[model samples]
Target: MSPQHRLTDLPATARAVIEDRTGPLTSVDMLSAGLNSPIAARLLLDDGTSIFVKGMRTDHRWVWTQQREADINRHTQGLAPRVLWHLTGQGWDLLGFEHIDGVHANYTPGSPHLPLVLQTMSSLAATTAPSSIDLKTMPQRMSAYVDDPRALTAFDGSTLLHTDWKPDNVLITGNRARLVDWGWASRGAAWIDPALWVIWLIASGHTPHQAETQVRAHPAWNTALVPSIDAFTRAQARMWESIARTDTPGQWTHHMHQAALTWAKHRQ
Candidate 1:
């Protein structure tokens, strides 16, 4: 991924648009480029308020994710940071969000943050997807990865799903966990989210069985069919394998690829 652009590096028009809403920035501090966004920064306004902003060139391949995050924010209410403003001009698209004062969730075994994360997931699973806009379905997203199309049915559902559960996308506050980066949100079986989390838990030091045991605390997991979970594990393993092969092969991707494989094997 390309390095994030400093706030000063924004085009004049883009800066003016942002400053108009923010009342001029007192300082611009760049934030970590979590997962997919090219530009992630925290803007401190002259009024002494701060907001987290993420942006990218208007024509960038992942530009749609910015729009998705903004569109999906309304449904995420208590689960994520609210979108403060959106700007599209001068060849850039940016979104300013209510800055969350929190730290990335720890998924390691026995971490206190795990229960908080699960609580948020259960809240999210109860949400209905916005029918006004088209959202991708998990089955469609994984179809290319699985050999038997029939297995994809296990993933289909109407529930709103934050498909990517990477720890960076989850922030642990004092008593709750707030999800971030909704670009990969999708419509899928409620249990699918817990299944996705399992791979990350394994990567975070939980044995596959231990990870599954943890997610069983989720109501959705109790309703999931064993074969369906098996199908998802298999598809996930193949999907990550493809990602590892095609996406510059980062260490994290390779690690996740292995994690998925381990989960898949444990299910067999």
Candidate 2:
């Protein structure tokens, strides 16, 4: 991954935009976590308030993600960081968010945080995707992975799906797990989000069956059709396989591919 940009590195116009909303920026602490974004930092204002900021060059390939994240945060209720403002200037697109005091969730087996993560997923599943946001459906996303495209229909739904379930994306805070990074947010089957988390569980050392049992607490997973589940598992395996074949496969991507394969084998 590329090195993230520091607030001081931003152009005068961008810094001015941030200061315009948040009284004079007094200090900046850059956060090095999060894989997709180029900027993640906490800005302390002169008024003693702190806010999180994430941004990227307007012409970057993933530039759209900044706007997508801003849009999804508006509808995420309390599941994600609240967007305070979005700005575009001096070649960068930025979003200011309410700072969250929390740590990334641990998804390993026997971790107490699992239940909270599941509960958060359940609440997120119940939310209807905002009608105004143009979201990509799961079926459309997984179409290229499945041999029988018709199987993709099983993933069709209006539920908002935070398709990325990496531990770093989930924050455990005060008896609940707060989700962040809405770049991959999609509209899909309510159960699909939990299903995505299952892969991460396996990657984090849970047996495939054990991971499935953990997610069963969600009503959507409990009542999901066997065929739909099978189809999704297979599709996920293929998706990870494709990702692992990238020019340079990261350790996590390779592990996820192995985990997806493990889950698909268990389904068989």
Candidate 3:
């Protein structure tokens, strides 16, 4: 991933955008974590307030994700960081969020944080997708993967899903886990989110069967149709394979594809 921009590096116009909403900035601390975006930092204003800022060049291919994240944050009341403001100017697209002081979740087998992560997923599953926002459906997203068009119907639903389950995207504070990075949020069957997490569990060293057992604690996963699960598993494998082939190949992407294939084989 490219190194993030320092607050001092922001152009005058971009700096003004943040100052217009917040008071004069007193200090800036750039966070060096996360894989997406070229800017991620904490802005400290003169009034002793702090906000998390993330942004990318407006002309970049993933620039639209800034707006998508802002829209999704509006509907994710208790689950995600609150969006304080959004700015698009000075050749950049930026979002400011309530700073969350928490540690990234650990998804390793037998970790105590697993139950809290499951509970958070349950909370997200109960939220209906906001009708006002244009969102992508699971089948629409996986159309390039599935061989049978009929299998697509199994993924159709109105439930909101945070399809990216990387450990860095989940923060555990006290007993609750908070989700961050809404760029990949989608509308799909409730089980889809948990199913995505299963692949992450496998990447974190759990066998496919063991990961399935862990996710079965969710009601959606427990009652999921066998055929629907199989279809999604196969579709996910293809999706990862395509990504691995097209995107810049790396160890992480390669491992993720392997994990998806591992889960698909278990489903068979």
Candidate 4:
């Protein structure tokens, strides 16, 4: 019921398209505090059905990113949001899907979510490129990650990476766990995603030491090099800072360019 529950930066065209699809929207609200794209105040349709919507830019990388995510979400069976639309006509670039009632995995995790969270990492990682020999989407690979600590180490690029795999990206409903927001995902080393999530947890409130323990305890990143994990966490902190200062989407370009150098170092 507060201002945080309403969408603010949406263009007029996006709002209209959403209205055209869902009928007259009511109780327009927004979810606040995230760094990437804005996702809030899900639209409710005529039958009392609701769908989450996120208005984004037309960056080809982002276009590729969201398209891949939509595929992965549906492919994961139930661990993600369904992609109902990506409105490009109205500067909306909307993504509509079923509304979820779970909260973000922001704090130290407990049972189901924790176990499944690790499992999801393993699952996504299982699909990474067979070899790190030639990595595509290099921009998302490591260029923007220059500020990340993991930039100092080599990323195998063989495992499927949920590049934005943080606690906030994981949603839990009852004992069930569903991974969401695969926008920055790719095929990379084992610890990349888990390491990213751990740093976010630590920087947000969780202690770095404890976060390292938690990440190491996970079967996915646990098998990875401890030093690489550390560097990854360091770089992730820097990336998060960049995200916080993201006044416009254009900065994402600089972020990737810087990260490329870091990721390239890991050619080994």
Q: Per-model C-alpha lDDT, please?
A: 0.87, 0.86, 0.86, 0.57
Locate the minimum summed-lDDT window of 10 residues in model 1: 1-10
In Å, residue 1's CA in model 1 sits off its true spot by: 9.3
For model 1, residues 36-129, the per-residue Cα lDDT tens digits are 7666778888989989888888988889989999999999999999998889877879899999889999999989999999999999999988
Write the number of the candidate with greater lDDT, choosing between 3 and 4.
3
Off by over 4 Å in 2: 1-13, 247-250
**Worst 10-residue stretch by lDDT in candidate 2?**
1-10
Order of candidate numbers by TM-score, starting with the best: 1, 2, 3, 4
- Candidate 4, residue 210: Cα displacement in angstroms equals 2.3
2 or 4, which is superior by TM-score? Answer: 2
**Which stretches in model 3 have alpha-carbon errors above 4 Å?**
1-13, 247-250
Candidate 2 lDDT by residue in tens digits, 130-156: 779988999999999887988988899
Q: lDDT tens string, model 4, 1-268?
A: 0111334755567678887776776656666644456444566676788787765656523455556555556455555767776555554456777788887764553433556666666666666443422234433545665655345446655565666654567887766667776666566666676766654444444454555566676566657665665455445545545644544545433443233324333322
User: In model 4, what lDDT does residue 9 have?
Assistant: 52
Worst 10 residues of 4 by lDDT: 259-268
TM-score for each of the candidates: 0.94, 0.94, 0.93, 0.68
